[model samples]
Target: MYTTKIGLAPAIHDSFIASEPLGHLLQSSKWQEIKDNWNSEIIGFFDDDQLVASVSILIRPLPLGFTMLYLPRGIAMDYENTALLDYIFEALKKYGKSQKAIFIKFDPAIQNLPENEKVIQKLKNLGAKWMGLTAEMHDTIQPRFNAVVYKADFDEEKFNKKTRQALRKARNSHTIVKFGRDELLDDFSEMIQKTEHRKGISLRNRDYFEKLVDTYQADANITMVYLDLKALLIEAQTMFDQAQKAFETKETTNEKKIKQLENACSKAKKDLSVLTDLVQANGDIVAVSSALTVNFGTHTEHLYAGTDTDYQKYYTAYLAWFESIQYMFDRGAETVNMGGLENSLLETDGLLKFKKNFNPKIEEYVGEFDIPVSRLLYPIVNKLYMMRKTRI
Candidate 1:
């Protein structure tokens, strides 16, 4: 009643994935182009002549000629269809055996909802080992928790007060957001490098970033936020002048108003001084923040982003991120994924705190699963993989 097809063409594979509700950019065939280090294949399951399911698998060579098969956020199919699920696993096992794959690992993009308990159990029933619900960032290959902003009429007024204030400050400071492809890559890369050094974590290099833009083509964008120091300086000076005049002309015996005027004058003076110094050191304009995003199907993902710490007060990152989201939506993307977050969802986490400003709904996935092909080698290979992962 069912048949399997290997090496499905990119367009055909992408079409099937785009048609599914759980479709993700990771499952797109173009992602294989980004993960060039891994040998990849697109496998499709069909009922007669109609394609029912598909997964883009990445194969990595392991020790002693064994291989590991990974389907990142994959198996773009209806999980409720029991028969299709069984047949697909069986087909994958047979294919894995042919390639001496130790096991096939996958972490579907399905959210961990109450109704999905049956799907998890069904995976176990098929002899796939469920990696427990991990709450840490490094506990799994892909993050188990993601922050997402679902599509609606875009409204800035709906944002929290702090976020709105930040956006206002960014605008008042004369920050400009520009979106492009390869042209902005250099600025984007520099910001990411600064972030890497500040956070003490390694991220993708320039070459990898280049590959992403090149492979994804029109769907990918690099957004850069630039600050016009000259304009900011003028604005700060104007504010300082107004505040100074207000303080001097205050006929009111209200000490509170006098104090407010004094504070405003002092803050404006400080900002003006800082902007002058920055202009002297950098230039009239400087790139303060940058982000990379990719749109696929109905969703857009904010992949990697960074900000120059020196210009932190300018809040350019906020403008960059918000503009990128707007840009993606303008291009017809329905959902914008803010990417991964730590599972704990603690307010103390700086990344979570920053992403929460946008008020995203946190999605917890069903974690990873391993379908062992060579039961004898799976345990050993998995152990080694885990150790290597931790070191990285």
Candidate 2:
């Protein structure tokens, strides 16, 4: 027999969730503090004194003394365990009634594969209203599709030619990747603002970034990519001098070799001049890109990232992403989630195109579900919510 316990200890709850296959950081007790505006609780299911299931629920107060319970990423439990699922859902429904909740909302991290159809049907059998499989970005509370890189070890060779070339160019241009906590937040925020202006979409602000860094503590990091113009200028000047000398010496008697030398000298001279002017206009070093990552269990999430459009040719974003992934892998992560992607999988989508270079596996998640507590109020609230989301 299973018994439900509310207000489970944080460490105990986290340990149990981390052991589950569907464990996620959003379901962590710490995440509750991040979403402090919502009244939250950690509920655990114990079978013979052994914790077998857990969910961190956020309570949103509604009009007329009603409430809505949301389980972000859903409960961490074995979906194959029908008995446990039935018990947990029954307990949740009772709990919702006690709180005067209109409904309970959840979107599990499980993939929408053929094998998982039975699990979806099981959820519906338990009275969950399955929000249809959606592909658009705004149709659900969380994205239905995600780009994830799953590997036991990091390998640059696995990346496609374009990605490898971009990494090489960033390295050749003297790009420096640095990792830190709040110290790098300013540069990260600046790059994010630039990205927002370029893409015309507002992402998280500085305060939210700061909160993430602070809340996650050692589990989170900000990786910044910088270009040392002074170093590049010196290197370019040296290359130009060498090319000019090689051309003048006429060391290669072949006409083809002579032409190659001439072109090399001309290109080197142009690069040297450009670097010199850039060094004069800007400082010795400038930030070009940055990424924010959070580590939980064996998974690392590349949550937010930004790059300066002016340095697009330098490919600093690629370097930042690569180094961040390396950092997470070294820290014992088996998977690095590259965050959400549009489900349409359009070839013209720049985000999808960029992530595809890394050869990520696209995860199509089972969409949201709503378990009605108040039959009449559930329909009204859900309809209003959908209308509001459509407008946004």
Candidate 3:
């Protein structure tokens, strides 16, 4: 006795299963809250009066008075239940036709599909066209990915040996590792910045990272990694020294002001030195990584990770990741997902290679699947978007 209906609005039935951030990130968050805001409708699916799935569709106004329905992570449902998928698509198609949507693009979270071809074939048979991975992710909503997942009974030793030499190296190094968000954020931000810079990319400023820490810190599962005082001290001293030297050369005629500035500098340097030693004394060693463990029922995903790449030679990143994985396993996590990456750009790229060294089995997923409601107008919109990209 199964029934299907589109829950147009969020309500009590949606609460049947305990909610988590993944669900919210996929459904509940306001349309405007997403960094790439979309204008359109969001719908949730219910079965037998129980909420089971949800979807967010972005309808972009196109030229010649047409629009398109772009579903980032669309059509969330019970993947194993073919009937449920069929019911949900019928509801979506009906809804799309009414709104004059050009197409519906869905990227379900179902991974490790036994037969990718069969699933694609079934979708096509269901009137959902298969859009191959062709364009850059910007052209689509979610990027095609091969996620690295640690299984329920993952062997830590096996994973370490298969992945990277660094994890062992990190353990051997005398670097202090501290977990939890109570630790200093400025240091973490700096470390992340250094890593990003090394990879020839710019990272969000300290404020953005601080927000992640502040928002998720209360959750005991969220962990932060810390490197030793010696490493922190080296960078801190270097930055301070450079600033102090520059300040000394500035044309300042006031003797009293100069003396006051010198005293401040001296104290600051002294404090920095002491703090460095303090961190060094609390040794866990080599490197550290901070991560937020997100739980959705029994499934847990590692959201964001910040690591000390400066000590890569010592394999701090590997050590930090290995320990973190062990920590997640101990917490009864069914899956420890490393999260998605810009794989196309990274494969063969040093960072990609580094992440791969961990011996993670690839979880291949569809790049972006779209169901066009009105194909005629969608092209015009696509052209304009391409033009804009070219201009940028």
Candidate 4:
């Protein structure tokens, strides 16, 4: 038998959460604070008097005096363990009745692997309903398909080879800037609006981001790819000067030194050309591309992002992600989740193509599940859910 309790010691919760191989940022305690409007609870499942599994449930008032139980990225537990899952369902149903929960929804972080067939059977055996496999972003609370960058034992430089190329091209046109509570709400809002307009997608408001940044503190950051033409021009002139000095040095004729000098001079001239063009076309900052990221345990996730399309030619967005990845590496994070993509498997998906530039592999999860507390109300709620999704 297992015991379900609300709120454990801080260390106990943190240790188990960090240890889950499939853990996610959404499950973090800080996230509970961000969703201030929702009634959130952290439930720990104990077996043999040891803290075994945990989950964070977000409850929102639904129609007709009922509440909806949403477990973002699902309950953090070993889904393959039948006994453990049995206890989880029992506890959730009992807890749901008291809270007037209509049904419990979960989209765990489990990936789609060949061996997961047995696990899928267990989920079914435990009376959980399966849902969703669409390529479109709609119809799910969290993305079912994700691109996670998890190679930490390897070289960060090798990982950044493509980013270095973007930096080389973007060097003379822009710079990367990271911001926090520094009035980023307004800037991010503007860029977010622009990106939504161009991409035909709906994003959250600035107020929501304010809460995210305010709550997550050390775990969250706002990074801007600032296209400052003046800064680029100054940097270009400095590089050109260095190249000129190196060309005039005594080692210019030495074969090894000559090769190095040529490479430097060639890069300086190429960057100067772009810088001159940018400075002439625009002054000061040409664009501001920003990305928001959160880190938990060994993982870092890039969430909402905005880009000023005017400077897309300069690849400022790529530079922004490059630096974001670097930030994760500096913190010794084992992986970086570059956010969501569609599972359509379409080779031409623009988002997929863009993320592929960073050489990240696509991860299609085992899919979402519906753990019904009241089987009678569960089907009724499904109809209402479809209506809500369409309205959105």
Question: Which candidate achieves the best TM-score against the true structure?
Answer: 1
Question: How high is the CA lDDT of each candidate model?
Answer: 0.89, 0.90, 0.58, 0.78
User: Who is ahead in TM-score, 1 or 3?
Assistant: 1
356 in model 4: Cα distance from truth in Å? 0.7
**Given candidate 2, what's the lDDT at residue 31?**
89
lDDT of 4 by residue, 74-146 (tens): 6778766788889988888888888898788888888778887788778877888887465556667787788
Model 1, 1-392: lDDT tens per residue? 89998988889989988878989899999999998899999998899999999999999988788898999998778988999999999999999998899999999998899999999999999999999898578889899998898768356888989999999998887888898988888888999999999999999889999999999999999999999888888887898889888888889888898888889889888988888898899899889999899988989989999999898887888898888888898898988999898888888999988888776789899899999999998898889878888787
Clashes (N, CA, C under 3 Å) per candidate? 0, 0, 18, 0
The model with the greater TM-score, 2 or 4, is 2
lDDT tens digits by residue: candidate 2, 154-247? 5899888889999999998888889998999999999999999999998889999999999999999899999999998899889999999999
Lowest lDDT 10-mer window, candidate 4? 151-160
Question: What is residue 76's positional error in candidate 1, in angstroms?
Answer: 1.3
- Could you give me the TM-score of model 3 versus the true structure? 0.66
lDDT-based ranking = 2, 1, 4, 3
- The reply for model 3, stretches above 4 Å from the true place, is 1-36, 39-42, 56-69, 79-86, 97-101, 111-114, 133-140, 160-165, 182-184, 210-223, 229-293, 341-349, 382-392
Ranking by TM-score: 1, 2, 4, 3
For model 4, name the residue pairs that clash: none
Model 4: residue 293 alpha-carbon error in angstroms: 0.3
